[model samples]
Target: MATCLASGLGLRATAWSQTTDGQTQAESAKADPSQAEPSSGDTSSAVKSDTTTVTVTGKKKAPNDRDVYDVSKDLDAKTGTAADALNKIPGVNVDPSGNVTYHGRNVVVYLNGRPSLMLSGDNRGVALKSMPSAYISTIEVISNPGAQQSSGDGAPIININTQRNMPPGMFGSLSARYSSPAGSLETAFLGITKDKLSITLIGSYLNNEMDSRSLSQTSVLDSTDATLQASSSKGEGRSSYRGPFLMANLQYDLGPNDVLAAAFNYNRMPSDSTDISHAVSQAADGAVTNLFDQSGAGRFVTESAGLSGNYTHYGQKPDETLKMDGSLARSASQNDFRSANTYLISTIPGNTGTRIQTHDRRNDKTKANMHAEYNTPIGDDQLTLGAEVDLEDNTINSRVFGPADNDDNLMVNPLLTDDFRSHQVVSAFYATFQREVTPRWTVLLGLRGEVLHLATNDLTYRTKGNINYSRLNPSLFATYVISSQQKVRFNYTHRQQRPEASDLNPHIVYSSDTSVDAGNPGLKPQESDAIEARYEFNGKGLNYGLRGFWRGDSRTITTVSQIIPDPQGLGNIVTQSTRVNWRRRSAYGVSADVSRQISNKLMFSADATLTQSALRNPQISGVRSATSVDGGFSLNYFFKKGDRIFASYKRVGKSYTGQGYTTGSGQANIQYSRKLTDKFDLELMVDDLFRQTRTVTVIDTPLLQTRFVSSRQSPTFMIGLSRHFSRFGPMRAPAN
Candidate 1:
């Protein structure tokens, strides 16, 4: 294999009420909307509402600073998870492993405009894949965030808003879905709105399944371009997960201008997986030097729980508020893996003997966060001040055993065993101001200061280290109106990405028979400067927009591999991979998107981006650049009785890495939904219609060259049934 490395990695203000031309305060707010606000700021134009007071009217509208997608009407919401719905949105990509990216940059996800410990921790992938999407009202994407946002390194932000504002009484939904190859899901939602108290509950049971295969070839070449050793392998794997998830949200109106909210979530997942592989090694003469077959199986269980509370107080003055939030979460996992290697041919002594290996690993993580922000009106402008503290504690224990050199008894392998612990703390403070300089012009300026402390301990190696860093980030956002239908906006910010505890572990971990992965404690954090300009036209039933962006980064982190002598004293050499920091990197891109409502029943939307990225390092001969193109398009048809049909296709572009590059991949999906009755609905969905989702990695180094292709079995067909009921009366569409 290509030695794949694991890098699994705010509200400011409603603007002061203003009137321009013949527009009223409500109309002006609707037209421009407050652009970038802190996550902890509750005075934003799109702040969450209590379930008892929601109202939606007329056609939907989007703010100038961010892109909003309404998924309550999408077919996927009836049967799929939040991850599936996000992958279909233009300019957003979610890989099969549940990692999310925006325009090829890293992303951070929020729930109801606030950070969630479960969504930001290591189990984020699993949680996103399991959480039902039926309750989602809209998703907002912010490409260039403001300093008020506490996102590390200026990462893009995605906020998910659930349905809110009920008329009172009780309302809920129940859904069951089944897919081919033993995959199924059951979900339930309950909401109660009585007087000043609002309660929401969600529960789900999921059984996820997957089947995939991989083919690869690796070679070791000498200075004369002759292959010293080569190996080829083919592997197939199957895995499944069974899980139960539960969540509860409570909101109480302390008074007309004050509110208190608390949320709790818990989930448990038990999984089993198996893999089989066959390999043959050949020398320069093309003679088989060794042959072996390997089979492996694993059983794992993971559990996570979280609790959060928030309090908001609105001042008597308009656009004035104060908010405080606190959250705590814990997650733990236990895994047991066993593998056996049977040799059929050998040229060295004792090579024909069978070898058995066993691995036991446990991981635990705890997170705590606290945030407070105050917003107040300053003359015709708005000012926001905020402070936040975040703490994380992680522990990992691993033990591995293998056959003894002289006997069949298993012996502990110290090189593959470790007990690691890490603690991290972040404290930040920020200030932001928004001004209406002219009738048609508005600007927001902000600055934030942050301090980070990280400490790690390796019990097995008896090694310890401490890292400390501080940064001051600044941001700017400005908007100019050319006409009633056209507007231009600009943004600039500073961003950074700190190395994770796992990335600085400094311990070698086995990836496969011929490869190993390790971390470097000496790695530095990556920092970048980013800027963007966008022009948009909104008129009648058609909307179109164009954007250009550039980012320059220092200390770029990427994976690099090298040929190393086998630590096990095996005759064959192995590939050892680790993360490294490059001197600098730069990327620039342009994007365009258009949407047209052909009729009341038909709509079409499309988006595309062209990006070029370059990297520089003194160790390399010259700077290298790679061009990438990615795009997506979607079509939706609405029928009578709330029936709908949706179709979409998305492609992810190829980009350059430190030592290698990956190929592009795309897939098509279709879904159909019908109203079976006044209170019941039926839906069907098919993913990877063309089965074109596949990727290839090429690693070319002076001494080692490898090519690996991975493809997942596509074509999953799912059917689902859902029922919606309410006692207070039929609710209106979700808020925009």
Candidate 2:
């Protein structure tokens, strides 16, 4: 099924206590020097015996295993969305399509230390692009997740912390942004609290228009290693996204240390795109064979809604808590596509005609989950136990229509029509123990066991299948304090990524007349083992960290493409692609990050990484390895009256697959934010300053080879205005 699974979505309450207290910790350390950790070479902890107190503030916080970056201090929070803000953070990249990565690796996302259906699977990209950054407080990156965290393909985790549910008061904010090339965004939020209850509501709408261009060349080779047929094509397209998003949260204090919470969220987005392409095909003798013109139009709509409830009880002792939560979510999507292809010149008889094709697809999904967790202190150590269960159901209907025999009427193509239904159940149990091995050393050990049951029915094919599997995952975390200002951490984890619903369905779908896609129902899950070590230093006005990571994966899933005959018996060659499990793969990388406050009003930060990745399979070639480098930097200057200027640039490294590789891409952006009044703010920004972002891919195989390049050059000029208000008092100004 199309399950929106968020690892530990409703549990993992301890993450909040450990990661969400940056401001609180800073305040405590400021108020009392004794509350701060003493380090031999640290200047921030310096204090006189009887006289003055010193307070040092930083833009980010690192507590043992994770790094938390304050989002409100950046200008993007005023002019952009959460996706835009994430692109500015070190070691983090949010691509034009809203895919998020850390150090060239996929990352699972969470909201406020808990998993949310909206932030899982395909929905995550849409949410990140549509959600306003004004509602965010901080962004947390967990390099090596502990056993307590949900695992996905052994990738890291990123948590987006939103500002909500404040003390007894009435608070709210409204923001609007307009951009050239036809784009607009609007956000509104309101919160009310009294006595022991708090309620929050957030709403946002985004309408963005963009243009894209792509060029591709494909060649078919003969037994003598000579090209038999070759084709080249160029396509131009325009697309837009328009959507409204709504969310509500409720929290109530049942007693001194008890709380109850409920949350509801709904989102709907409709998108459309149109593209035209011109292609020419040549024979081995370089003779023109066909000149083709193709035009396509597509429309897609997606809607989702979810409801969740939680209960928490805190014990008298610190870090002791019991939590339980459950959630239900439903999502639906519809896709309609139409395409027309005309051949101006052809070698075959009666081939200079126009062909029309249409596709209609609809998918509906429902998911329910229950989770519970308990954390307690044993002497000076900590122990946690948790359990969770999830259930998912999905239904999909797909139909393809092609030109009828000799007539203009359309007929349903049986080979490309299908009805699919799937149901899945997953259960997991985990335990983690933390202990202080010494005054300067700490360790955490964890183990998790999970069981999955899946069943699918293909009514079109009259086939039914059942799959079940179980596995154990383990994780370890250790940290040693090297000095007052420096420390070292080591981590190890095991993770798995299962095949999604689309990957498990055995239906052949046509992307174009010359391209087809399908799935393998017998594919195995991918598994990975990862280890990492990091060294961190917090100096007077400079902070830096270096991390080295190594990972090995088995049963790695990779795409494989081959030349095949056209399914319609049209005497044409087509590309058929599917996913398969590779034998092994390994990757190792080193990354570094540094941040400094150059002056009272100026701040600078930079990061760089070097990676060596390799893939191996027995079916074809030997081990293939690639080395790549990635780097980025940002500069922020704060002016009087809460005005700020921010500039940043980032580049992603190249990536490789079994038969192909994709080149890297880069972009630069600048923004200006000004406090116009006590309650109003203004912002101006420019994105893709140099318009240097593009994707280039090459695939070489024995029978077929292809090269493709895609570029989207939309340099955005945006202006935004926001306002803050509170019924109880004037809202506090944002941090810089």
Candidate 3:
């Protein structure tokens, strides 16, 4: 199609051309079809009735892999830990509590397309918090995972690709940073690559301290709908952490089509600190019901080590492949806690002294996983088959000494002294088919079947529980190209969330002066059915995406709080928080992301998400619904003087959970970098610009309502000097 000439006399005309097909012609005049004939001789003719248009494209269309993004190119991230860098990703959010979510869905984290034993269980956040970002080459957030992924359906997956085939020869980088709230961080990366072998080492040392103050106001109502007690407590404390982390990977090309890789991970937090807090309570009539002053201090020492191996056999066919991965890991932790309270009010019956309690916990965990996948082409369709086996054995020894009871015996709660052991095993098999049914349509179908065996024993309580179950999960994905530059996708999957060992422990621990925390042994696993639809567009230099998702879950586990008589029998009342399963839970949301480069020197990007979540249970609060909105933006500028400035801001809305709710806070970060030399750079960074990222929560329960707030992020300024050495090859330059 072509357009020419304005419908006005003496109108100025400009010429433009776009290629509709591989054809070109210069027509001198319109002729009757019956008399039309080609000129046999002189092709030199300079008369035309209409101007022809043609367009040439310099590059092929971008690939349809919407789930992958280049870490360095997409996010102008400086040298920082993975936790500090993840905030720059689109549609990814990390809350104040170190929980990572993608589009309001729980995200499974992986390493090099496989689950690493180093990141087993609830340690992903810890790994990200300490591991340097330099170890990562790319971060792939799979929004619609297929059957090859052993993870649950509808759940997102984040695969952190390690630095493969390190810059030829020997190269390394060193950086050190100092933060206000968090102490000092020093990290280094060393890589040696020669021929078909590559070995890389990355390590970090961190010594950080966090100080925060929180105020919790609680109201206890009686059966008559009258406030029986009102408790307001304000506490302040500080916790310091010092640790070291090291990870090494070795890769060797066994042959033209096979590769073997081995890696090891180790991290330790051996330093322990002491913290104390005091709380005072009042009555509903504004009287000093309990003037008890309580203080507690705790110490924790934890260490983890793991080793893994992976082998990849790329068959003769480009896309045919077989992969095998295996890993084994062990983590150990020890905790010692003690608290003392002086009753300014009256003490318990037959007692004239304050209360003292001590709790000690020793935990050890061992895990092993083996997985294998085969990828092949079946005619015009692609097929993937995989199997995985996971085994975990955990043991926890706990002992607690409570306050003196009426009989002068302080060890009143027998459940506090228990030895918990848990053994879990899972075997799974999955199959996936991706077929290009037509030129413009693709369909993906996957099915997974798994058998789970779990056993738990409470040696002290003389109780045990066993579970044996099997489940089959099916998923479907459909993608249709609306045009050369636009596409639409739909996906559905089912996922399950089982209770961790800690969630099933029955040990009682006092989290604060007025709060007693415990776990439920009879807790059930949660399962959800999720579906998503996404539309994507690619223009000149801009990318845009919109997605909508909904999930329905049953047996949702959540923290439930209630006012109860002091289990320690020290008078007054206290709040007890425990985990419970909800009858039903559901959430739905829409999200959007945009990336555009306005010019060569400046660029801007933005993302927004909105969600509505609701939960109901007959045993907890009746039913509640929460709606939230989250949005963020960033700006980057590259100056001609070999300098760069990057700034970002994020404002997240409220997040909902069973029995309680929390509101997200605003966060901001900025950085400036100067290129001192081709191999060395100087940079300044700042975090928590607003210094107001706090965890604010509200617990609306049948017997009590409480409001609490705790600081998460603090204003921190840091200066770092980085040096890079590329001996065998030149490296990619930083932003500037």
Task: Please state the error at residue 580 of candidate 3 in Å.
Answer: 3.2
Candidate lDDT values, in order: 0.74, 0.75, 0.67
TM-score (all chains, Cα) for each model: 0.89, 0.89, 0.85
Which stretches in model 2 have alpha-carbon errors above 4 Å? 1-24, 27-63, 72-79, 347-350, 404-408, 568-572, 727-736
Residue pairs that clash (backbone atoms under 3 angstroms), model 2: 39-484
What does the lDDT come to for candidate 2?
A: 0.75
lDDT of 1 by residue, 114-225 (tens): 6765666545666787788876766889888778776464578998876654446788888898887678889998988776777889999988788888888889888766
Candidate 3 residue-wise lDDT, 222-254, digit = tens:
666577777766777777777898999987767
Residue range 1-736, candidate 2, lDDT tens digits? 1111101112111112111222333332211111122121111211111123322222111235576666655555654688886787787998767778887777888877766668776577678877887667678888888777765456788888776435446888888988879888899878787766678888999888889999989899876679998888899999888999898888776754577888888988899999999988888899888787889899988888899888877665444668899899988889999887787887756565887778888889898889999987687677889999989899988888874333368788888788888998989999988777886788888999989899998888898888899989998988887875678989998988787776777877766767877878898889989899999877656778899999898999888888876674443557888888988999898999888878879888889999999998444567888898888988888899888888899988888887878998888889898989887889998988888779999887766789989998563788899888842232221110
Total colliding residue pairs, candidate 2: 1
TM-score of predicted structure 2: 0.89
Model 1 CA RMSD to the hidden true structure, in angstroms: 7.4
Indicate which candidate wins on lDDT.
2
| Alpha-carbon runs more than 4 Å astray in model 3 | 1-66, 74-78, 95-97, 104-106, 116-123, 144-146, 151-155, 283-286, 347-354, 402-413, 506-510, 619-622, 713-715, 727-736
How many clashes (backbone N, Cα, C below 3 Å) per candidate?
12, 1, 7
